[model samples]
Target: MGFDEKAQNKAQEFQGKAKEFVGDKTGDENLQADGAADQAESGAKKAAENVKDAAKNLKDGLTGN
Candidate 1:
């Protein structure tokens, strides 16, 4: 987990919202699906980052760094 990954995940989440809105407005099922997928991925990414950060913290603690 790092700043860049966090920012990218945030950006992805926003973009997915835009896509979902546009899809709803235009009645595009594919776009809506894509947006949903994007949102899911973004959520997963953030979760992964959190896990990584926690692991890093544990490592640093053991190593005294």
Candidate 2:
């Protein structure tokens, strides 16, 4: 919902992508799984933030913010 949170999520997603790439190249299944999990977690967090933002927007609109 904020710049800092968005930046952190983007960083985490990027890190996950790098890990996944390295794991695939080196044939490390565990690392690959970890990377996938990280990506999923980032995605979930982003989604939650989006929902919160939408709710806030709706409330603000109703209250004439």
Candidate 3:
């Protein structure tokens, strides 16, 4: 994935971790769930980007790039 996309995903993942930590310390179930969802979304985005990169690499290889 591109640098911008990777950085954004990392930021999101970090934010989620922070949220989870705060929620756990404060005993906020909803916030904890939200944090988990955010982390999952970030993970999904990263996975999709990885797949796209892999496909691009495969195409470039076949084309002798």
Candidate 4:
């Protein structure tokens, strides 16, 4: 994936981690769940981007681009 996407994914993961930590400290189950959801969403996004990038590379290689 590109640098921008990578950075965004990292930021999202970090935000989730912070939320989870705060939720644990504050004893908020909902916040903890939200944090976990956020991390999962970010991971999905990154995986999608990686797949797209791999597809593009495969196409380029096939076309000798």
Candidate 5:
């Protein structure tokens, strides 16, 4: 099956949240930082996806989708 970018991003976001929670519970500073970084990366990817689709839509509009 083709990879779903949205699903991937959501999964990453969820994972980051879980890690952040676990790290906080365990008092692991490194894990918490990693989780925060992961969350940022996932958010950036989602934003990129939004930009990509918007560009595609603009192209389609110009060409008639």
Candidate 6:
């Protein structure tokens, strides 16, 4: 299957971890910052997906789906 929002966000989080690890090993401040930003963005995306899913569930419940 194509990447869903959850999968995309999870992949992004793993990528951030890899970057952070590389930055730490290489002593690259910019890379570290970028990795942190990526992680934050991933977290935000996950939160948004959660909200959307919750909304959909609520709507479905109300509509007897």
State how far residue 19 of model 1 sits from its true place (Å). Answer: 0.4
Ranking by lDDT: 2, 3, 1, 4, 5, 6
- What is candidate 4's TM-score against the reference? 0.83
Compute each candidate's TM-score over C-alphas: 0.79, 0.90, 0.90, 0.83, 0.83, 0.80
Instruction: Please report, in order, the local distance difference test score of every candidate based on alpha carbons.
Output: 0.91, 0.92, 0.92, 0.90, 0.88, 0.86
- List, residue by residue over 18-53, the lDDT tens digit for candidate 2: 889999999999889888988999999989988998
- In the range 1-65, model 1's lDDT, one tens digit per residue, is 56887798899999999999899999999999999899999999888878988999999999999
Candidate 1 clashing pairs, residues 3+ apart or interchain: none
Which ranges of candidate 3 are over 4 A from the true structure?
none
Which digits, one per residue and each the tens of the lDDT, describe model 5 over residues 1-65? 12686787888999999999999999999999989999999988877877988999999999999
Better of 3 and 5 by lDDT: 3
lDDT of 3 by residue, 1-65 (tens): 67997899999999998898899999999989888888999999989988998999999999999
Where is model 1 poorest over a 10-residue stretch in terms of lDDT? 1-10
lDDT of 3: 0.92
Q: Record all residue pairs in model 3 with backbone atoms less than 3 Å apart, i.e. clashing.
A: none
State candidate 5's TM-score. 0.83
Model 2: pairs clashing at backbone N, Cα or C within 3 Å: none
RMSD of 4: 1.6
Superior candidate under lDDT, 5 versus 6: 5
